[model samples]
Structures are given as structure tokens and as C-alpha cells.
Target: MTPQYMNISYHDLLKATSGFSSENVIGTGGFGVVYKGIMAVEGIITSVAIKVLNLEQRGASRSFLSECETLRSVRHRNLIKVLSCCSSIDHRGNDFKAVVFEYMPNGSLEEWLHPKESMNSQPFESLSIMQRLNIAIDVAAALGYLHEHGPVPVVHCDLKPSNILLDNEMIAHVGDFGLARFLIRQANISSPSMTSASGIKGSIGYIPPEYGFGSQASTEGDIYSYGILLLETFTGVSPTDERFTDVSSLHSHVKMAFPSRVLDVVDSKMFLERQCPGTKTVCAPKSAHDCLVSVLQCGIQCSKESPRERGTMKQVVRELDSARMLLLR
Candidate 1:
């Protein structure tokens, strides 16, 4: 059943976003522009992020409907909460559509992972190993819920770091369901090579190899993206890094030095060394090393070239949790 949305007028959104001022713009994407707004909800003043659809772009209207359809049925703590959506006309009477979401104060995971180095920006702190581990598990948990426990299984066709938002508590919330698809047919869900042939699938570098061959969006495809996300999170190396030459993707780059030379590829800012409790001088690097290796291996397994070989989101969650345990120990 689709959840009933709060009816909101276009004027209200315009006012809340200060006439959709350029200053209120928070982010931009293919579908539309996102604005940070302050609005009244249930008699309480609330901060919201409003995504106004371009509508002029082909598939933009479809993306809006897809997002609304997918978000209506799926509810998870790690998933971004949608307050409401508007399917109305602008002042000029042109078709206008927008979706309202809970404002994430900390912005996106992408900002934290790769902060902009500008003199005008404030100094940003790098995420600790513990924090990164927690984030990894948080994202996996969301995907696991979507793929296995939702009313209808969902395929988050776009699963890049930019789509992952961070709340006040720094908890990761997977957002941007514009390209999501519901696995309604059992055959499509079961077959690894099922091809739906959508015009465009997902972001470059994050898209699975099978998707390039016109494979339908599947849980396995999500797993592949998650694997690349996991690898990038720990190594601080994006899948599209300049260092990756032809035939040398992030999967292969990490595979080359996985167990033995993981530290060499690991982000220098991340402090993985944990000292044993009650010992001021004795550090347990080996335990942390082993835990890192486990996490990276899981990433490798998830990003395998063959769609059938990638691990499920459930398996990825288990592996990441175990790695967290190792790190804590």
C-alpha cells in the first residue's frame, strides 16, 4: 500500500526555500536541484530538503514517479525519510513536481570521504577507522533490508557515496531512489543475467560490468556497487582514480596487494592500530591488520566480474560486522 503524503502547495515550498533562491540551493543532479528549506510540519517548524524536478529533461518525470513509488513502500532506519511530495503546477502553470525529505545536517558521505580543499572552507576531519566501519555496516544493513525484508524487493540502481547522506548523529542514510526498481517478477530476480535494457543504468565506475551488457538491475548489481563503495571507503581511493589504467580497476588494484600490502593502499589518515586495554604501550596491530584484510576480501568478493559470483547484501553485512568485532577486540 502506498503511504498517504502530506499535501503541500508549490507556493509553500517556494516560500520555505525563499522563492527558490540561488542561495538556498544545496545540491544539483541530473533530475533536478535540491534546496534547503525551513517549513512548518505538524505545527512544528522543520528543516527539509526539497528536490524540484526539472521535468524538461527526458525521463525526469519518470524518475520522480519512481522515487515516490519506491520510497512509499520501503522504510528503514538507514534509509532517508520522505516527508511528502508535490505534483502540481508552478506559477507559470508548467508541470512542477518535487519531493520533500528530512534534512540531513551533516550533508553527504561524499563530503566526509573526499572533502573539498578550499581556503574558504572550514577544516574537515577525516573519518576514523571505527567510524568508517560503522558507516560500512550501516549502508550494508540498509541494502540488506531493501533486498530481503522490504514488502517487495528493491534494487537501488544508483548506490554511490554521493547518494548516502549523513544525519546529525553521523548515521548513514541511503537516499536518491530516482532510479530504483522493484523486483516484481520472480524470474528477473532469480536470473543473474536478466536484461531489462534501460536506457541509462547508474553512475560511471560504480556500475557493475553486467549492467554495461544490458543486464537488469538486481540485488547482485547492488552488491557489486557496494563492494566498490567498501573498497573506496577504506582505501580513500575512488574507483575512477587516475591511477587506475586500462584493465586495472579498483577491484584488481586492491586484489594485487590485498592480504599482504593492504596498508600500502589504505588511507594514511585512518588510524587502524588499536592498543590493548590496560596496556599503555602494547599495541595489537596484527588483530587490526587481520580485520582490515577480512573487510577488503569481502569487497573483492562482492565486486567480482561475474554477477553470479558477488556476495549478497546479507553476507556483506555479516562480514562487515565480523570485521568491526575484530577491530573492537
Candidate 2:
């Protein structure tokens, strides 16, 4: 059956989201708060992430509408799916708006990577090298789809690990389109006014140098952010660390460390028991050293300071695919 497009009413959304109860709330950000919700139609249950706007806040309505417009028009497997939206006055007679998205049970990549809170007795296992490579490929594919397959090129202004969610199947989904922008014909333009208190457009560590130079947000900026994410995934360290503060950028830090055979910076959890004898916690594959080398090399390429020097998402995806195939063999 074809899925009919219908705007969800505000009342229906409230019931689906349990009246936006705090217990159901899963996450919150500058744009809005996200709540876990269940919807049943024809006796079929479906889980969703409901993003409810903070109407009392300034500029919240515009951001909500902007995200709605972007997600409603774009579609991709790696991108979060927006099922519907609700925009109406609530019982308090205040404006209410929300977006319903496919729920990601596993939560954001940041939780897995940094984990602010301890995962006591959670049977937490570090992701294998192969798993990391697969996630990078999935994210690249999603970005590629947005830049090439969509009706208009979309720039995900904020591409940090926190915004990348992993589903139950470990499939990566790019979420938080609140800061996304459409890239029409490429031309120089002034930076968009910053919305947050930081006075910075993108996340601090991931913001592209080009953006500082007054270049408008472009696909290249997204590429730069992707590179930072890749580096963060490989190395358990945050991009802006006291050690790396001396270095001009994350790219340079990684590049200098690469020549020293210091992939040891990679997450200790990722290698664990797999680490080679007489070495640090970093692991070396039994027979796929070449594959590991390739993946690391791709990371280096992506982290290049010059956007023109970095490989496209298509190329990144292909490289990861090749590495994954080698690891499987």
C-alpha cells in the first residue's frame, strides 16, 4: 500500500508522545527536545522520535519550519526519516510544532564513543575496526545521496558524532537537520548569522577553516566536518585537546602521528584482547593489515586541511567498501 502523505494533527501527536512527558524524552538540543513515542495505525505499532519545539523561545518556529521543509523534500537511507509533523496551538493556547522521525534505538554515536555516563553492566564492547569502517561508509553514502541524488544539494552545517545516530542494526543515520542549508549555484556569500550563544556557526572543533575565511557553508565544509568525525572515531580523543592545541588543526596532528606509527591513539576498547603482543592496546589484524592501512589512509585523506584535497564522499564510500571486503576475506 502506498503511504499517504498527511499532516499529523497536534492532538494526535500529543497522545502518541505521551503528552511530551519527561520520562519519554530521549534527547534535547538547541532546536528542540526529542521524545520517544509510539504510534498505532490499523493495529500496527511503530516507534518514532518526536521533536517538539520550545515555542516560548525566540526563533524556534523558524528553525522548526526550516527543518520540516528540508526533511520533507529529501529522502535517503542513511538520513533520518521524517514521518510527519504537527503544527497547531496546544491546550495552553501556545504555538506547538513537532516532527516525527523513525526512532533509533541504539542512540547517537557520541554515546558509544565518548559516553559521558558510565555503562555499568551494559556488556559494552568496543566496535571492531571493520564495524568502524562500515559506519564511515554508511555515513559517506548518506552524504553522497544528499549532495548528488537530492533535488538540491544539502549542506549539513553541523556534522558531529552526536548528530549521527545508530539504529538497532548498527546502521548509521544522519540526524539533526535543524542547521542544514540548501546549496544552490555555488558562489561566495557572507556567513549566516550565528544563532547560538557560542557565536560560532558550526561546532567548535569541527568548523571548517574556510568558514572562518568568510566562505559560505558548502559541501566542502561538510566534508571537513566529516573528516573530523572520522578522526574522532579512529582516535578516541576529542579533536580539540590540550595536546592537539599546539597543532594548527586535527588534520596536522593526525598526519604527524601517522608517520610515527602511532595508530595507538585509536580507542583502547576497539582493540582490547585483539592487540598484538609487545604493543600498546591498539590491535593489528591477523591477516588484514593492508585493509587497516587502507582505512587509516582514507582517514588521513579525509582530514586534509584543504577541502579541495579531500576525497569526495563517493570515493570515501568506495575505499571503505574495499577495506570491508578485504577484512571479510
Candidate 3:
């Protein structure tokens, strides 16, 4: 069942975000800016992430509506929670639209994957092999949920690390539905709503090859993206890394070194943490390396160029579970 939508007044949103100041800004993308704010709800102070739409940008309004409609019906532990929304007019009488969500303290998976130099010149700790496994499963479960429900399977057109948020407990939650689409199986393809107007395939490097050729988005495309994200999580490389040339990508980069020199592509710091155990990140058993190999194999399979060749989310979920089981043993 779709959760009840909470309607927030524009004045309350302005107050919650402190006039939408730059200091409170937590994230920004094609849609708009997300601000971390404290708002009193039912006489209790609460932390919330307010995503204020940039109406000046094309499709910003559509993104808001798409997110609202999609998230309204779906609920999952691995999915970002939508607390409320403000769709009223601003003080200037201009159009105003914003969404309020549960504030994720750990920010995005992108931040943790590629940590910036901190104030003290130290980078944030990398995610452990176990943590990566769990995060991958979390994401997979969310994607599977989206594809399994309703009259049609929902395809998250845009899937990337930046869109995956982590909470205070390090639990991963998928966010940002600006480019979400509902696959209309009647025509055996994603609705033209995605391609007709803007021809948006997806973020560079993360886009499936089929989508580039005007193929409608599908569950297979979402799986392909998940494969790239999974590879990046293990290798600590971004799909958009500058080193990839026209003939190569993160998938190819990892493939070239797989089985023989898998560790070469694996994040050096992360490998050390996994191997050393108590030094930095949490430690798993010795089978961790072998488990990662199998996990990478699953990623390679899901990211296959041919949509027919890609495994279903059900298979991907099972393989990830097996990998995690191996790590524990």
C-alpha cells in the first residue's frame, strides 16, 4: 500500500531549511539541492533532508512528480524513506515544490567510495569487504522490490553510487528517482516518456548499451547498472573514472585483470583492511578473497552487453547471498 503523503507548508519548509542557505546544503544534482534541516514535527524536533526543486531546470517538475508517485507506493528497508513534501507556492508567488526525507547521516555511497581529504588531511575509512557485500545486497533487494511490484515492473533509469545513501548505522538506502520509469510490458519496453522528450539514457558510464541505441529501459538495464556499481564497490573505481578510454570502461578494466590479477584492480587500502582485519575496516574470514571473486563473476554476468545475457535480479540476489555466506564461513 502507498504510504500516506504528508503535506508540508512552504513557510515551514523555509523555516526548516533556514531560508535554504548554502551552509545547510547536503547534496545537489539535476533535480535540485538537498538541505539538512531540523524541523519540529508533532512537537518533537526531527532531522530531515529537504530536496527543493529547481523549477528553472527542464524536467525538474517531472522528476519531483516521478519520485513522489514512485516512492509513494514502494516501501523497503533498503529504500530511502519519504517523510513528506511541500507543493505550495513560495513567498514570491512563484511555483514551489520540495520533498522531505529521512536524513541519512552517512550521506551517499559515492562519498564513502571516493572519500575527499578531510579537514585534518585524512580520508574517510573505506567500506570493508563485508560492508560492501551487505550494501550490494541491500541495493539488489531494493531493485528487486521495484521490479516485482505493481501491474508493471519499475525500472530505475538512473542507478549510481551518488544516488545510494547510507544511514548512521551504515545501512544503505537507494534514493533519487528523478529518472525512474515504469516498464510497460504490454509493448515489451519502457514507456516512451523517458526517450521521447529528452532521450535520457542515464548517467555516463552507468548507462546500458541497449539504452544508447534507443532501446526502452528494462529490468535488465537496471541489472547492468547494478553490475557496474558492484564492480566499483569492490575495485574502488568509478565508472566515470577519467582513465577509461573509448575502448574501455570500469567493466572492461576489471575484466582484463580478473581471475589472474583480481587484487590488482581491487582497492589497495580496502584489501589491506580486509587482510589485516583489526587495522582499519572490519575483518571477515580468509574466504573473503574467494567470495569476492564469485561476487565479481556475478557482476560480470549481469553487466553483459546483451540484455538477454544478463541474469535476473532473483539470480543476482541469490549469488550475492552465496558470496556473503562464503565470507561468513
User: lDDT (0-100) at residue 307 of candidate 1?
Assistant: 82
**lDDT (Cα, tens digit) per residue for candidate 1, span 1-329:** 66677789999999999999988887887899999999988779989999999999888998999899889999999999999999998999899999999999888777777887221133557888878888899999999999889998888989988888889888999999998887765554454332354754789889999887866778899999999999999888889989888879999999999788887777756763543466533243776778889999999999999987896888888888899889888
Candidate models: Cα lDDT each: 0.86, 0.76, 0.82
Pairs of residues clashing in candidate 2: none
- Worst 10-residue lDDT window for candidate 2 reads 191-200
Alpha-carbon error at 206 in model 1, in Å? 0.5
lDDT score for residue 1 of model 1: 62
Q: What is the full ranking by lDDT, best candidate first?
A: 1, 3, 2
The model with the greater lDDT, 2 or 3, is 3
lDDT of 3 by residue, 261-325 (tens): 67667776666645554454434445877887888888888888998898788888999999989
Q: Best lDDT goes to which candidate?
A: 1
Q: Which clashing pairs does model 1 show?
A: none
lDDT per residue (tens digit) for residues 202-244 in model 2: 7888888878877667777788888888878877677776676
For each candidate, what TM-score against the reference? 0.91, 0.86, 0.90
